[model samples]
Target: ATGGRYVPRAILMDLEPGTMDSVRAGPFGQLFRPDNFVFGQSGAGNNWAKGHYTEGAELIDSVLDVVRKEAEGCDCLQGFQMCHSLGGGTGSGMGTLLISKVREEYPDRIMETFSVIPSPKVSDTVVEPYNAVLSFHQLVENADECFLLDNEALYDICFRTLKLTTPTYGDLNHLVSAAMSGVTTCLRFPGQLNCDLRKIAVNLVPFPRLH
Candidate 1:
């Protein structure tokens, strides 16, 4: 995943091979452990087919190894929460492929994703529409609660609210992290009604694929 441009490695300051005082100074640093990440040697070239069929297949085993290790350590494993973009090859194709593979092992577990959908106005490549739709099809079958994030909406927020002339991926990710933190707050803190993933899923998703 670090092969992709958007993944914020600094969030997990502890995972880095070399320590950075500036990154560790941040409030949300060291959120992830060193074993929580897997990286590919190369990118998927912004193509869905290349990601899912080629690159994803190559990395699937390694990714699953990490998942199995993490799952083993959990006493009461709830589910998985993934954050990726539907417009990019790695996030869209590889992301869906990985989720599907994980589903084969943990079929009953809930799978939720913060998926960044493609936008016509702000796209990274010419085939983003194709990538998004193709990835969406796989997600429809594999994921349970797919929280869609439209790039155009994020762009609008950056343009109008944040007053940014040219917004970078870091800016957009900050907004997304805020939303993600809100949704996952109940699980992380006390005194919340829906304090678990299963409860939130039951309350928010009444029907299959309604997300």
Candidate 2:
């Protein structure tokens, strides 16, 4: 674990070519290995169907290999957790594809997801609702539990609570990161109320589809 936190062995996948290089140069670059990054032919250009049927299928094997390796290294492999936006092509389409494949390959392992749903008032993509519906179906079918993050709610929190008149992407990301950290604090830090992923699912998800 890095800095007393369980730093996951991750395999970052994207549809845009050369996007991995920019990600690798970021602050979290040291957390990932060069081989753990996978990219498709090019950007999906907000085409969810293209990401799911074409690029997602093509890169399945490579992504699974990395997942298998990470699971093998774990002393007690518990489950999988995925984070993505439901309005984007790669994040929604490819993310759903990966979740389905993971469920197929590892039937016993639990899968949880943190999905960002687009705000109707602020969504940029015309087909975002279509992408969201498709991805939500896959999440219900494959993931054992899901945490929904609404863009409008988060935007409101930034504007009203945090007093950010014009919140940038970085500010929004920081908010999301903070929420994630708070939810996982029991797993990361030792305390009286020690909670695992299973417990989290039990408490948060009363019904699989509702989650």
Candidate 3:
């Protein structure tokens, strides 16, 4: 997933341990470092591993509206390059609903998504499997592309390459950030990418087939 044919960027909600100062920064930058993440114990017990979920539809919806407004506000922008969505639960589920509104708002602007599917270990749980398949399917219907990342396979790469002693939260976030950086660099650097937005839309494919 690190060395893909194209690169991508993100517009995340939070940034830099998230104090009051940096609310609603542009989609361009974030800490994206392992150190900034919060580690917590799940509600069931006080230790092992537990992932939490929220009914964040309203929040996601509002955020998408903000992004659409910003995209429209771009003075130099003739037309949008693409709208990116996430194929995962928060990204896909929340993302799908948001893009629909965006399409209504800006009919011709391109919308794309960079989402990850759950790994078998994570997918063994009911929530991830359900979210991944259902959300991803919906995303494929509307988004320009769903660049899939298998957490399991990616983690294996991190462990092997980074030589992490324990696959701690820090290690995991680093891997995710690195992969994102790789994508961003590839697409934005000109000539580095084998394909661009035109190729993807015209052919409906990820060309250059970087694997």
lDDT of candidates 1 onward, in order: 0.77, 0.84, 0.46
lDDT-best of 1 and 3 = 1
- Among these predictions, the greatest TM-score belongs to 2
For the record, the alpha-carbon RMSD of candidate 3 to the native fold, in angstroms, is: 9.3
**Tens-digit lDDT string for candidate 1 (108-157):** 89888999888888777998889988987888898888888987899899
lDDT of 3: 0.46
Better of 2 and 3 by TM-score: 2
User: Each candidate's root-mean-square deviation in Å?
Assistant: 6.5, 2.5, 9.3
Off by over 4 Å in 3: 1-57, 76-89, 123-125, 190-196, 200-211
Per-model TM against the reference: 0.81, 0.90, 0.58
Q: In model 1, which runs have C-alpha deviations exceeding 4 angstroms?
A: 1-32, 163-166
Candidate 3 per-residue C-alpha lDDT over 105-142 given as tens digits, one digit per residue, 9 for 90 to 100? 76666555556666667443445555555555555555
Per-residue lDDT for 1-211 in model 2, tens only? 7566555577788887676877778887767766788888777778789779987778878888989988898888778988888898998989999999899988988798889998889898998999999888899889988878988888899999999999987888898889888878988888656377777777777675776
Residue 208's C-alpha lDDT in candidate 1? Answer: 81
